[model samples]
Target: MGLAGALATPAHGDTKAPAVVNDARLEAAYVIMGDGFATVRIVTGAAGCPALTIDAKAQPMIVRAPHASLPLRPTASTIANSKPSVFPITVCEASLPPGAKRASVDGRPLPMPRPVIRRIVVIGDTGCRLKASENAYQACNDPEAYPFAIVAAHAAAWHPDLVIHVGDYLYRENPCAPGHAGCAGSPWGYGWDSWKADFFTPGAALLAAAPWTVTRGNHESCERAGQGWWRLLDPRAMQPRHDCNDAADDVTGNYSAPYRVSLGQGAQVVVMDLSHAGKKNIAADDPRYDEFVSTHDALARYARNATFTFATDHYPILGVTIPDGEPDKPPKAGNKAFQSTFGQVDKGLVPAGVDVLLAGHVHLWEHVDYSGNTPSQFIAGFSGTQEDAVPLPSRLPVDTSPLPGVTIRQFDAWTDGFGYMTMERTGARSWKVTVRHADGSLLRRCRIRGNHTYCEPIFG
Candidate 1:
C-alpha cells in the first residue's frame, strides 16, 4: 500500500475504520529509531519473508537525506511461538546524505528526524487487552471503550517533533472468545497480527509523524512478548538473550544501557530501562541495585551538561495510587528502592540538575513535585489499556522529615480515561506541559522553570 493508503486515516465524527488490517506481506508497522543515526524496521507475516528493498528516492518523500536502494537484513532471532513460526523482521540502516529531502520504503514515504525538536508527545502502557477475564472493566473490543487508534490520530494531529513511547507495545496475551464486547473472535497470540492490531495499525498515523524512542516495559519481557519487542522496536544493535526464564542473563542494549539523545536548544532526553528491576527488597549487595545506582549517577553527571533534562523508564519511582487491597500502606519495595536511590539528592542517588522523571506502569496520570530535591515525577500511564480505578484523598500531607528534606507540595491524579501529554519548549529553560484527555479535552496545564513547576486547571 502507498504511504497514504497504509496510514490509518480517521473518518468524520466519532467513528473510525479499524486501523489495523491483515496484510500478510507486511505485518507490523515500521519504526523510525531515534538513535544517533538513521534506521527503520519492518516485520513480515507468515507469508514467508520477502526480499526487502528500500528505494530512498521514491515518491511521497519521507527522509531528508539522499540515498540509493538499500536492502534490509534480518537480525539474529525471529519471533518464536508464532502460529506459522516464519515471521521474520528486516532492518535498514544508512547514514543520511547532506541536504537530503526525503526517502521511501517499499514505495511508501517515511518520516525523517527533525533538525530541531521543540515539541514531543509522551505515551505509555498502550496495549489492547483481549482476554475477557482480563477485562474486568469491560474495556476490550469496543472502539469507544478502547480508543487507541483515536488517541493515536489525535496525537498525530499535533505533529510533535518525535514520540517517546515508554513501553508495553504488545498485549494480546490470549485469544478473544466469541461474543466479547469489542474484540469478538479477535486473533490472539504473540504474532505479527497481534502486534499490528495492538500497536502498529492503531498507531500508524502517529508512527509516520516522527521518529520514536521506544522503552522496555515488563510486558515486553522475553517470556511474554519479548520476541516482538526485540525484533521490531528495539534500537540496539546486539540482540538480547532469548531464554524466557533467565532474567539475570537477559541484559543488553536498551535493557541495561542509558541512551542520551540531543534535542537541540540546550535540551536532552535520557532513556533508561528498569524492566529487570526485581520486586523484592533490593539489598545493598544486589548487583542489579548497584547497577541501577551507578546508572543514575552517570545520568546525573550527564544531565549537568544540558539546560533541561528529562529521564523516562517503564516503572515509576513515585506513584499516586497504592496497590490493590493495600490502600493505607506505604509504597512497594521496588518503588521505595527507586525513591531511596533516585529521589534523594543528598544520598547521591539523583543529581540536582535532572528536571523531570517521566514514567508509566500504574495505568494512571499523576504529577508529584518533590520540592526540587529529586526529579519531579510525572506518570502518564493511562495512554491505553484498563486503568486502575483507585480513589484518592482530597489532600496529602507534606512531609519534609525524610532525607534531603523533600516534600510533595502538590499532587494531581486522573483515572477518567486514556490520554497523553505534549511538552512544548517555550524557551531555553522553560516548557509548557498540557495534559489532555484521549478525545482531545484539556485536563490541566503546567509550566516548568528550572526545577520548579506550577500548574492550574483549565475549566470550560
Candidate 2:
C-alpha cells in the first residue's frame, strides 16, 4: 500500500550491506544485478513465506515459497494486488553509486535512497519460416517451422530487462521461389494459428521470459491490412492513434500512446508508431502524405526530455544504399532526402532527448548513424526471414555515397543471415548497441549519445 523499497550493494557480492525495507514482515529487499538478468529471493519466519508474490517490472519475477507450501495457493488479496508493493519502488538496471548505503528495515545496511540496475537488450526482425536450398526460398513444415524459439532462447541466455521489436512481425510479401509450393496462399493472409504456429507458440520461452514492446511494419499492412498486427503485436493499441501529417509538430496521437518506460535514473524509452505513413502502395501525392508529415511532427515533440529516446517504426527513414536512379522509393520522401527533413524532424522533434531510431521492413540487417542530423539511426531489420533464401540481391538497394555519421552493418550468414541486436545502457545518457550475428559473434557496435556524434562502424 506504500512505496515498495529496495536494498542494493554498491559492488557485486557485497553481503555486509543490510536490507532496506520498511515492513520486514510484509516487504522484502532485493539487490538486482545491473549486468545480466537479475533474480530476487524472498524468505520469511516459521517456514519460507508461501503467500508472497514477488514480481519485477522489467525482468520477469517469480515468488518461491521454499517449496514447502505444496500447492502454493494465492488468495483474493494476491488477485487484487497489482502495483509494485509500495507507492513508488525504485528500479535499478545501470550502475551502483559509490559508497551508496541505506538503513535496512531491521537496522541492516542498504542502499539509502533507491535500488536500480543497468543492462537492457534490444533486438528484432526474427520469426522467419523458410529453408534455403539451391539459393531459393521454400517453406519448411516441420515440428519447429519458425526460428523464433532459438532466437528467444539465446536472448534468455543474456537476460535483458526490455526487448524492443521494431517491425515486420508478419511477412506479407514472402515471395516464394517460382516452383516452391510450400507457402501457397494469397501473398499475405494470416490466421491466428498461422501467427502462433509461427512465432508465439514456438517462441514461447523467449516471449514469456521477458517484456516485449513491438511496432507495426509494412508487412502487417500487407496481409489482411494490419489485421494480425492489431490483434497480436500492438500492445498499446487502446491508447490513441496520432495524425501522421501533424506528427512533426505534435507529440501524442490517437494510435500513439505516449508512455514513459523507465530504466532508472531518469532513463526513458519513447515508443511511437509509423503505421500512419499511408498504405503500402499509396501515391506520393495521396492525402496519406499528410499522415507521414503529422507523425514526424509528433515524434519531435515527444523527444523533448527523454534521455535516450529510441523511436520505433515499421519502415526505415535512412537506408543503406543510395538510390542509383530509381528516384521512386520511400527514402525519397523520408530522411534520405537531402533537405535534412529527417534532420529537421530529429532536431526539432527529439532535439536533445532522442538518441536512437530503431526500425525494420527491408528484411535486411542495416545500422545507420545520422549523427549529422540529431539522434542517430539504427535500421536493424533482417530479423531472419524466409525471403532471405531467394536471391533478390538486385532488389536490395545500394548506397554508393554514404552519409557522414552513418554506419552500415549487415549479416548474410546462416539461416538467411538471421540474428538480433543487444542494446546495453553503459552510462546514464549513453548506450552501446552491438549487432550480433546468429552465431553470437559481434558484427559491429556503436556508441550513441544524447547530444553528441553517433560513433559507429562503417560496414562495406
Candidate 3:
C-alpha cells in the first residue's frame, strides 16, 4: 500500500473514513535553482507522483498564476485550423507547491505544471459608416483608404493574443461610398458575402491574427436585417446559449456570452453585451435590455482586482451638442434613435463596477463623467468617415447624481479624423488609455489608476 493508503489503514480505534479530498483547492508548485526563476513540472494524475525539487538555498517566492482555464480547446503555438483551440492557462502564487523539496502526500507524487500567459487587444465600432456625403466622405470605404489595412497595422504592431471588437461591423441601409457597385448580396444591405468580401477580406490581416469576441450595436437590430445579424456573428445563436432573460416579459434579457479575461495578477475583465432595445433600434423597455443589465450585475460580483470594467455598444450618450435651433432632432428612444441610452447606463452599469463605457454612432467624439471625481467614460468613434472638425462645447451636460468620480470631456473642438485607442498596463494596478489619430498621432492620453479614478488629461 502507498503512504496515503497505509496512513488511512488506521492504528486502532480510528474507524472514520480516511478523509480524501478530490476537489481540494489546487495552487501552484515551484522549484528554484540558484537565484533565478524556478522551473515547475506538473504531472497529469494522482499516480504521476509529481515531485517538486527546489534549490536548498532558494526560498519560496509567491508568483502569480499565469494559466487561465478556458472553455475552448487549448491553442499551443499551433497554426490556425478549422478546429478550435484553447489559450494557455493562468497560474497564481498561491497555486505553487509548498516546501522546498519533493511534494508528496505520504509519498504520492503531485503533478502540476507552470502557468501560461496570454495577451489581449480591444477595439470597437469599426467599419460601420452612416450617411456620408457622396464625394467628401467617400474615402471611408475606398479600397485604397485601406480601412482593413489600418486595423491590420495596429494588430501587427501590438500583436495582441486575442481581439475584442465591440460591434457595429455593418451599417445596414447606409449607402456605400460613391463607387461601390451596390449592396448586392448583403442579407440586410449587401449580405454576408458582400460584408465578408469588403470587411473580412480587407481586414483579413488583423482578423487572421487573433481570436475574436464580437458584440452587437444598434445596427445589428433585426429591424435592419430581420435576424441576419444574430445568425451571422453570435457564437450561440442556434445553440440555446446563455441568455440573461428567461420569462416572456422579464426585464433582464441579454443575448451574448459572458466572458472573463484575466489580465494577469489579480486583475480580470468581464465583458458583456449590454445592448438593449430600450436605447437603440428596438422599442424602449425591451425585455432584452433588462436582461443585459442583469447579466452585467452578475459578472460584476465575481471579477476580482478588476479595477476597471468596460462596456461597449455602438451609441454615444454624451459629447455632441445640436445647434440650438437645428431642425433635426435626436431619436425618440432606443440606441440609435435617441439620447436616452444614458439612462440605461446610469441605472444598470455604474453600480455594477463598470469604470468605463465605450460607445459610437454619433460619428463625433465625446467623453462623459457621471461621478465627478473617479471612474471615467468616453465615446470614441470617428473612424472610417470624413467629416469637418467641430470644437467641443464649453458648457457640457454633466450627470452629478451618481457622483462616482466620472468626468466627461466636452470636446467642442471636433476634427475629421480616423482613430483608435490603445489601453496598456503601465503598473501593477494602473492602465494608460491613449487615443490616437489614423497616422498614430496621439490625441488624448489618460492614466487610469486606483478606486475607479483617472488623472488629469495629457493632450498630445
**Whose lDDT is higher: candidate 1's or candidate 3's?**
1
Model 1: how far residue 376 lies from native, Å: 1.3
Candidate 3 shows a clash count of 61
- lDDT for model 2 comes to 0.43
State the local distance difference test value for candidate 1: 0.62
Question: Which candidate has the highest lDDT of all?
Answer: 1
TM-score of 3: 0.56
Which window of 10 residues has the lowest lDDT sum in candidate 1? Answer: 59-68
User: By lDDT, highest first, what's the ranking?
Assistant: 1, 2, 3
Q: Tens digits of per-residue lDDT for model 3 on 62-181?
A: 111122221221111122311221113222111223233433322333322112214444555555343332223234435335354575566546665445565566543344443554
Which segments of candidate 1 are over 4 A away from where they belong? Answer: 1-24, 27-31, 45-100, 131-138, 177-179, 240-248, 251-254, 278-280, 328-334, 340-348, 400-404
Relative to the true structure, how large is the alpha-carbon lDDT of every model?
A: 0.62, 0.43, 0.41
Error of 1 at 370 (Å): 2.1
Using TM-score, give the best candidate's number: 1
Superior by TM-score: candidate 1 or candidate 2 = 1
Model 3 weakest 10-residue run by lDDT: 28-37
What stretches of model 3 exceed 4 Å from their correct place?
1-120, 128-148, 172-190, 225-232, 240-254, 276-285, 303-307, 316-349, 369-374, 385-391, 394-415, 451-460
RMSD of each: 9.6, 13.9, 14.8
- Please give the ranking of all candidate structures by TM-score, highest first, separated by commas: 1, 2, 3
